[model samples]
Target: MLAHVTVTGRVQGVGFRYSAQQQAAQHNLTGWVQNKADGSVELKVEGPEQKVDRFLEEMKAGFTQFIKVKQIDVDRFNKDEGYKQFSIK
Candidate 1:
């Protein structure tokens, strides 16, 4: 499973990408996270259904002190990008 996620709020320059990368690693997920020009954080993660869901849950729950997750828009699909590891892009 793959999830294309957009996180909005106090996300930019607040260690969101790195935090997300760590979380993804914890979930054994593979993909990438990047900061968008629109002040949002965009992430693509691929893994098992349960792990992906857990990763999303952690995202919504605010994994770090600096990250205040106000909203999350996720589009889930059955596509694989063959990512070898989670990273910050």
Candidate 2:
């Protein structure tokens, strides 16, 4: 399964991408996480349903500068999301 998550708030420049990469790697997820020009973090992760869900949780509640996570837009997608090994872009 695949999921695309857009996390908004003070998520950029606070090791969010690296943190996400670590979490994704732990789950053996393949995808990418990027910093949007608007300051949100965009992530596309493909893996087991449970692990992906956990990734989403970590994105929202994990140690991200200890700032409030304002919004998270999650989209379930088919298998062709196009990615390999979590990355930051």
Candidate number achieving the greatest TM-score relative to the actual structure: 1
| Residue 44 lDDT, candidate 1, scale 0-100 | 94
Report each candidate's C-alpha RMSD, comma-separated, in the order given. Answer: 0.7, 1.6
Every candidate's lDDT: 0.93, 0.83
Candidate 2 error regions (>4 Å) = 65-67, 80-82
Q: How does each model score on TM-score?
A: 0.96, 0.88
Worst 10 residues of 2 by lDDT: 59-68
| Clashing residue pairs found in predicted model 1 | none
Report the alpha-carbon TM-score of model 2 versus the true structure.
0.88
Q: Model 1, range 33-82, lDDT digits (tens) per residue? A: 99999999999999999999999999998888888999999999998889
